[model samples]
Target: MHIEQLKQKIVAALEDLKAQDLTILDVKAATSVTDYMIIASGTSSRQVMALARNVQSTAKELDVELLGMEGLDAGEWVLVDLGDILVHLMQPQIRELYDLEKLWGEFANPINHQA
Candidate 1:
């Protein structure tokens, strides 16, 4: 799928699970790994895991290659690699510590998700 389409699918998946403070950073210039970085918060470990799984399943349905996934076992944070789009699912505290939005916030293109 195209990057934009993949982003939309991922965003939809996150929204479906009520991900909080969802943000999409345009990191094409900042990194060679991916074009966009999607960051979101889950209320708890189970929610975090569920959110990650949802995105993975969505990607599979769309035939989007999932390069890698991490933090599922810990559930404090989960990263989904969707070739051109990278997703980060985390709890409030873990999100605060990493502060990915702030780190790459300036580069982010606005997303329509509620914060």
Candidate 2:
């Protein structure tokens, strides 16, 4: 799938679970690791895990490889690696602490989305 289509699917998956603070950062020019960084917040650990799982399932349907998943046990911050897209599902508190959006925001234009 194209990057834009993949990003849409990811946003849909996150919205399916009612994820908050959804932000899509375009890091293509800033980094070679991934084209886009999707950051969202789930209310709790279970919700965080659920959000990640939803992304995984959706990605599978799209034929996107699930590179890896991290922080599932702790559920504080789960990172989903899909070849060109890196998803970060975190609790509101954790999101605030790390402020990943700002970190990556500095490097390039970060697209602030409201799904």
Candidate 3:
């Protein structure tokens, strides 16, 4: 499957798992680091790790080659990079500190969810 389709599948799965405050930013015009940025939160460190793990597993099942990650060791924040699509699974406190959603105002929408 195309990377964009794979990335969207991952996002939908995350939302199914209630990844809080999920935000999808179209960064194509903003930066070269990636085309899309997916920022999501978990209620706790453990849940954050679980959410990251789920993303990893889903990628594996879909046969998408995903970039390996770090921060799962700390369980505070985890990043799953699928090339053009980057996913951040973070704890509430960590997310608050980062404030990623606010950083990308252009991709704003009425998602109305907080994992």
Best by lDDT: 2
**Which residues of candidate 2, in runs, are more than 4 Å off?**
none
RMSD of each: 1.6, 0.9, 2.9
- List where candidate 3 sits over 4 angstroms from the true fold: 106-115
Model 3 CA lDDT for position 15? 78
| Cα misplacement distance, residue 97 of candidate 2 (Å) | 0.8
Tens-digit per-residue lDDT, 1-115, candidate 3: 8866876788888877878878777777777887777888899888888888889888889887787677998889899888778888989888889888787766543233344
Candidate 2 weakest lDDT stretch, 10 residues? 106-115
Candidate 3 clashing pairs?
20-114, 20-115, 21-114
lDDT of 1: 0.89
Task: Give each model's clash number.
Answer: 0, 0, 3
Give me the runs in candidate 1 sitting further than 4 Å from their true place: 106-115
Predicted candidate 2: what Cα RMSD to the true structure? 0.9
* Candidate 2 structure quality by residue, lDDT tens digits, 81-100: 99799999999999999999
Ranking by TM-score: 2, 1, 3
lDDT scores in order: 0.89, 0.92, 0.80
**Which is the leading candidate under TM-score?**
2
